[model samples]
Target: MAYPQELINEVLDYLDSGHSVREAERRFGVGHESAARWRRLRDGNLRANRPHPVKYPQDTVRLALGLAYGGHGFGLDEVAVMVGVSAPTISNWKRRYVEGGHMDIPEIDLGEIKHLSPDGRARMTDEELEEYIHKLELKAAVLEGTVKVLKAEGIDDLSNDEKAAIVDALPAGFTVTEALPEVGLSSSSYYYCKAKPERPDRYGRARAAIREEFALVGGKRGYRYIRQRLREREDPIVVSGKTVRRLMAEEGCRVSYAKKRRSYSSYAGEISAAPDNLVARDFHAEAPNEKWLTDITQFSIPAGKVYLSPVIDCFDGMPVAWSIGESPNAELANSMLEEACGQLADGEHPVCHSDRGCHYRWPGWIGICAERGIVRSMSRKGCSPDNSACEGFFGRLKNEFFYDRDWEGVTTEDFIGQLEQYMRYYRDERIKESLGWMSPMQYRKSLGLAA
Candidate 1:
């Protein structure tokens, strides 16, 4: 089928970028034949537009016919080579001349036989060519319409009403007669669906509310959280999670995340004594201040590299305290630990888990934890999953905030400020499905654990 020119160009550009046609088809959802044909056309192999050498003298055909009919054991294949025409042409001449009692071989316009038949035959008329291209364009129009309105790949098993809606949404230059069959709808069914009054959208209000919530968070929240917020809003949109998901998708409320990059490591050769893995990858906490996981992640911008160290509570994934600095030194870890320790209630000592990083192994970090009566725990040598909870937090943070952004001209301080702002948003505004669609701060307030 003839894909839209924009999609064709995109696929071609992808191919030109050193990717295979198969890769382009998979990536762009284009058919392999169409992509390969377009590639051929791009490479100056215009098979469709190229002219075939069909010009031959009338005498050459006459000679070829005589050789075929001669009783000298000459076959049609042997005779066709005597002249400059194909075996099929000689056969056509014999059928039209000898069998039909014609005086002479009827002249056929060889130019009209330029296109290859669908069964690999070399005989297709102008009318057949037009019909083939028209069918392709119709199929393409149907595909484009389905993607635009129905958000689907093909019209397989779609209800008549849905198919009719797709037909109605078809672009200009396409007719209902052409689109109806492609979508598997009868003309009468299409007309009947069109004549019926339009059904009211059940999720119209939900769509508007979802758009607002999506924009409020700058499209960082997913549908599950939005569904919860919809139910909790003053004018609640009480709908199922599936309905909310559909509405958000229909409204184009999506968060585009980025691929993960190699994380910045702080593992310097053992600078001080290391503690045992007390948390043991069990990040779940029964109460606040039971376990705290701390890790330092680096963010590189055009201005410079900025480091962030945060002590995340095992309960509700809340960042109890965080410190941002230009360097990931002992002070960065120490200050964050101190701030986190300041929030503990009387006789509350949480196990602060960290990786085997020099900052965490230093005496400064040890002294602060020892004086605060906070327990220290460390992952094994070069084992990150031992501190997987903090690693997970960093993964979420980078995916949601750091990546997918163009930080071309921002200063280090400004980047730090933005990072700090995102952390606040993460704790107070961003909803988590694990927390029943409430932020960490909101979850804390719900439990009367925090103001």
Candidate 2:
């Protein structure tokens, strides 16, 4: 948006009247660049009669062209001010003059005779006209090459802000409209994309809440779990899980952990006699405590391995009792059996099943079972299927709790605490499809089996 000659004169008048350049620019609503150009032109003793930087009328456009070649030491802006137009417009008029050797001033006749000089080249020599034509042709070729290069650069793939920046960085005389087509963007789309995206205040508030809750939960829970827990609050807020996920994506929030695997071993050689495979893979139980499964599984952390021995009632997948220690020994198994015996009321006698590992076959383990009036059952040697129920418990426990965690920072005591917490959460919070979407405690409660 070029200012008019009147404004430029006003700017110049202010400077000549001893006003600062900045003050002159502020008064004329022009920038420092325009003021500096005015100063330079004035210093060069150059003045245009009435040049406008924006547009030129009919006769003015032709007069601008003629003055450019008239050889009165007229620069483009000097020639432009003679009829109130820009240097680029003066240049465009020059392009027409040399290329066509005639003024095809259709839109700019202004009731004037049409010629570079009066009477159609009456005042100009043939050689001078020819030379001007040759120079104009060379300039036109360069301009065309520049435009072609710009078009071939494929700036269309750039982002809108990037394209806008490039357009802004163009030479002073060029407009963004000229560069828009080269970048294969419409003027409307460029302007629209350059504007900032508006988001609602609720959106900001919701994102804050999501971040707070996500951070509060240790950031390990996925979006689904986050959404579920949010709904479970005392003052529940209804929000879609999909919305939660979208907000998570916007915040760059992710579940803190990925799944990894671990392996453990049990002492398998029979230091004592191995029991018969009494349960024989008949894992189904018609009532609580009818059949029980026990196993000693190991968890390895950076601190070292911590062992867990648990008694699970096959009837409900319920962990009746469990013991954890730094070592998986006969004491671990016996302590767990003692807890299980305490879980039984006056009449309940469960057939305890296990793999043929030394922990289960140890004299301490067998003596406890005998004293508790519990039948002892074992898998065949190195055959896991015979104790598939017990093995299945280990698989489920590892898959659900142990496999996906980072235990590198955990000590044996801390790992034991976390393992116990997971067991409690599994019993009271985690749901199973086979249990009709209820946790073990919930299912027992539903069946009137617990106080």
Candidate 3:
């Protein structure tokens, strides 16, 4: 079925704005193949595909209109019969030429004549064949050169500036118009990109500030955090978060970290009677030191295995205290808990939650909590998500720091020192999206809860 030209334009515009063709199908209620064809036609790359309705050449269209308007007063049906088209189609063409202006006429070429069948080329005169072969040579040259410019990706994946590079790289005699069709770029877009260097960069200062912020945090942040940091500056740089993301990609101010899951369980099977699940997967706390989650994660280095026991406050994901040692023993867990309790003021007894790990279930660990009036909470046997807030902290810690580093030949003591430094950095500097892109300490200061 024929769709209205206006509908086609609207769908193509939606596609040009960086949405996928499948999304356009659902949003515009158009068929997927039809929308994709419209996109290719708009990009001027309709080379191998046949036109759906067999579009007649512009010369034939002009001739048909000329005979209809020859002042013989022929009816629409007479013109239709002569041109071998329906009467309504003839009438529509006449209306489009007269009322809508001749410029609105659509010209659909059957691609370059060289792409036609052999018999189709035999019908052409020698001069026409020469012109077709000459055009083919130009297209071949452009395509060959553009391969280097595009690398392994398709031309449509490129930005306008990248496409214009193909146009600019054309041989001296070839014009930008000659190179555009090969690269699926329009003349207007090519010239617009050509003139871009003359225009002052609108995001110059903002790009510098974003890079500084991204580098300030060791490039582990996403764009939202970088944008929040920019806005928080004394002399703020107010820009869209999307703009920050694009600039980050363009300036190479992004981190690449691959995640690998490593599991280490301290569950020694019923060390003692576990406490009730007091937090019950609700990791939120209104005030600092109100709720605490603790867990032990083992990191295997070439030197040896290093274990970390951290007590994380549920309020803002702050690492309240952490102890790194060569072994995952009661000493590591006890020392971390002792340091965490030492920071609490009187009457601030937080619920200490943990998995059914023997370190937390042991008498020494319980005695410290009992002396400090800290309520103990425990997850059910072998359940990780029950104490997931603490598990999530370990996930982030390893993903951002441990997973990507090379720990070859480093002593356990040196590794512990480095881990200590990272703990300090994570607490004081690493921004969290849940805390409005502020570090744990920063968020506390913002709430007037810290010095």
Per-residue alpha-carbon lDDT of candidate 3 for residues 1-451, written as tens digits (9 for 90 to 100): 8989999999998877645677688888999889999988889976774323324445546545655665545566776765556777656666766565753433333333232446768888888888777877776676777687778455556677887887787778777766676666778888888898899999999988988988776676688788888878998887756678899999998676666665678889886998899998999988889999998999888999899999999988999999989889999999999999999998899999999989999999999999998999999888889988888888778766777668898888998898899999999988787787788999999999889
lDDT of each: 0.79, 0.71, 0.80
Task: List candidate 1 segments past 4 Å from native.
Answer: 1-158, 161-188, 195-200
User: On TM-score, who's better, 1 or 3?
Assistant: 3
What is the lDDT for 303 in model 2? 96
Q: For candidate 2, write residues 104-193 as lDDT tens digits.
A: 533334224223334554644687667556544543443454555457665534565555555555555556665665444568878876
RMSD of each: 16.7, 22.4, 10.6
Candidate 1 least-lDDT 10 residues: 113-122
Task: Return the top candidate by TM-score.
Answer: 3
Question: How many steric clashes does model 1 contain?
Answer: 0
Candidate 3: the clashing residue pairs are none
Runs of candidate 2 with Cα error greater than 4 angstroms are: 1-196, 201-210, 239-253, 256-263, 270-287, 301-303, 314-316, 346-353, 370-422, 425-439
What are the per-residue Cα lDDT tens digits for candidate 1 across 151-258?
554545567778898888887778878677577777998888887777677667878899998887667667767877887899877665666777777788878877
Question: Of the candidates numbered 2 and 3, which has the greater lDDT value?
Answer: 3
